[model samples]
Target: MKHIRMILINGPKRVGKTTNANLVADMIGRSLPDGCRAHRINMADRLKTLTNSIYNVRTPDGQIAPPDYLEAIKDQPLEIFGGASFRQALIYVSEVVIKPRHGKTVFGKWFLDTVNQVCKPGDVVITADTGFASEIVPIINQVGGDNALLVRIHGMDASFDGDSRSYVHWKHVLTFKDDTNAPFRIGDASVRPDVLARGGFREIDVTNELGFPERSAQAVLDYAARANWLVRPTEVDLELAKGPTL
Candidate 1:
């Protein structure tokens, strides 16, 4: 079998990336290669959860906790005075945590080391979050090395009647042609470049169910089996041959 390592599950919030990834991971029995793992990049929420767990506890030193107790609890400490809880959990093979560091930090060598340490040969590292906003492709390029696969899941509801009485924003619904190169706006600024750079393999039409649940999950599995990312050369190779774009 081809060494299929690294899979990215990208999508809008609450669109079932996590749920689907879990289902798929279970379905394939041996879906995950040895040393391979799955994770959710909810750094803020995760940090809060971790902080809350050991938040107000008095240290063994019999003194009050330190000021940076929160930072000391992350899965991986990106900074000097980082946490150790996350680092400990990540020592195992099946641990899901959030991704810290934005921008170049996302592709930093330390970040790669953490992943490489947890990930082994034939491993499939998965990220089920809105990480598609920035360096999606470059991140994938960096992670997958040469034989990795990247898949993005899109959660959309297309049943807008454009009624003035509708509760949801009917005008924001995507149209037929709008699927291609649609502008993703975040607040006043446009985060389109980040999303587009990572791009998507196949856009799942989740309009009917509005929550891919199992279909989207199965689609990702099936797509990985036959997706171009699995066969395409390394991201650097593609960039060298096609020109540096993302």
Candidate 2:
């Protein structure tokens, strides 16, 4: 239970998640106390190296199993290699077979370890958000409990549903909406609206309110700062935002 003030900037793709994250980090560094540090957990950079290995049994014709085709040759048998040989191969693949892991090489526990290092007692940690907001909520709990706070900057998109989208959604979600009795659950964990409000967590509907064009990162950050979060800029940051020097 270290006291950490964490802000999770989440939303759909092209929603300015990164821009807001960076701005928030910069603001925290300037606005907070002298010793406070504003750090960004760039998940994309870290997770781009994830291992995505597949155990494929190339057929005699050179046609491999379709990627992500997970119909096990169990229960009712199908064609192809068939019988005992297929069963043995499947067992070997399941047990001793080693395949390349796709996506980020390190996940779950490893991610938490990295985050813990970036965080301090009074620092503001802005997670470089991914589409996996719901899925990673548990990881946040594991890393920062009463000490950390989660804020999701929402974007309007019909395709942002957890199931349909590539960004896998988890059952346990702690959401911030204008809902009464809306206790969002993350895995087995849950957070109520009142709790979030008390903990300095709130939501902003950027799609309608903010006149953000498609995929503009900077616009998203501006919207968040104006609406809910305050991003205090440093001299360097302000210069960067204004554009590079000649």
Candidate 3:
């Protein structure tokens, strides 16, 4: 059977996990042979789709808006839902309703199903929004440990100051809590150090210091070098090739 590489990006809120995923996808797409490209998928996509359906709302083009758009208008009260903001509604449906009914691995199962259907041989599938271990363990198991890469992004400037997202408090939730000592802590949440300890899976740590573009580019370069893929010369290389500026 043809194999695909799966990159799972894990990090706190607003730390550019999605940015890195997209950058890695683009980089892989350029390096891979013709007819094979990278694909970006979010673990929360199923949640967003369910949220949109429950609210009976669709984008202007008759499609559901992604979670980021919902987050942008998260505080806007929904009249039909008794003034609950989009964020509140999503939390209710996901945590309170779905998990209680369908189990915690429901989203994970859906994600795996999607990956099985859509991902082909030689494709690099990257996901930026991997929060809980429950959501990704099955993926690692399915894709086999050797084919998966877990990238943990650390944003030096990131803070939990005013953020009230459910994920921020996940470490405290009984079902999601990890008993093992975490390697790092982001706000109140542990950064899934347990998941990182799994054998046979390659792990990468990216410190987001030079902002998204530079850091993401650096990440892709690192990944390419590690994966033995053809490394494309970056802008820095081009500048260096011309010698130092006076």
Candidate 4:
């Protein structure tokens, strides 16, 4: 089997996760071989489509019906469901039932089974999103171990970025209150942490290369300059023709 490689870009919100992911994708694309190509897959988009509005759902007749909607999912048994007592049982149900299902699309059985629907071997898939790394990383290690590259982007400077990169602004309902008792909150929220204790990967500080004095120093440029080492050579015989190593 071809050694499949997946570059997982992970970081907290407002940390330029998406922008930096695109930059990495561009660098990889520019340097890739003919048959080898790089593509960026935003798991956030796929996730929203997979999980229908599980929280704050409304009845067709216009009645608030979050709990009624969660009634169906409450049956699925998730042990982690009991740890944190959420203000809204409905939201909790969605957490345990809906979000965990993303693993099927992320890096395991369902991912391999349906990968051809979007990707193939020799394809470098750069993915970005927020979920439980502890749970997701294990599955990735189990299935794609050597083929996966987990990238943790850290130390954000959103001020100079001149834009709102946080998903809280876009995906969140802003004024969401699951019920009268539930606190008004942002989104069906989560954070992507930098520590992946088990996965062997790269940690890039997206901000370290940016800003006034260091304008020319960029993470993408640095990676692009050295990426050739990471890419498999398209031809070995041609290289062997030159010389042999000691």
Best by lDDT: 3
Best candidate (score: TM-score): 3
**lDDT (10s digit) by residue, model 3, range 69-174:** 5666666787856888876777689777676655555566678778888878877788887766656545654555557776777765664344333231222222
Ranking by lDDT: 3, 2, 4, 1
Per-residue CA lDDT of candidate 4, range 64-122, in tens? 54322433343454333453222233334335554354321232223343344566666
If scored against the real structure, what TM-score would every candidate get?
Answer: 0.42, 0.47, 0.70, 0.48
TM-score of candidate 1 against the unseen true structure: 0.42
lDDT of 1 by residue, 1-246 (tens): 124344545444434555655554444323443444443332123333343344343457765444234433443443432454433333221122223212221322233444555545555555443232232334333433334344445445422132111111111111101112213211212223433354433333321135225555555556665654233212122112222111
Instruction: Choose 2 or 4, whichever is better by TM-score.
Output: 4
Global Cα RMSD, each model: 15.1, 12.1, 8.4, 15.3
Question: Model 3, stretches more than 4 Å misplaced?
Answer: 60-71, 75-81, 159-198, 210-212, 229-246
Model 1 weakest 10-residue run by lDDT: 168-177
Window of ten residues with lowest summed lDDT in model 2: 97-106
TM-score of 4: 0.48
Quality of model 1 by C-alpha lDDT? 0.37
- Note the Cα lDDT for every prediction shown: 0.37, 0.43, 0.61, 0.41
Each candidate structure's count of clashing pairs: 4, 15, 0, 0
Q: Write the per-residue lDDT of candidate 2 for residues 92-170, one digit (tens) a residue.
A: 4322331122111123334456667777766656774544443344454453334443444455453453222243332
Least well predicted 10-residue stretch by lDDT in candidate 4: 168-177
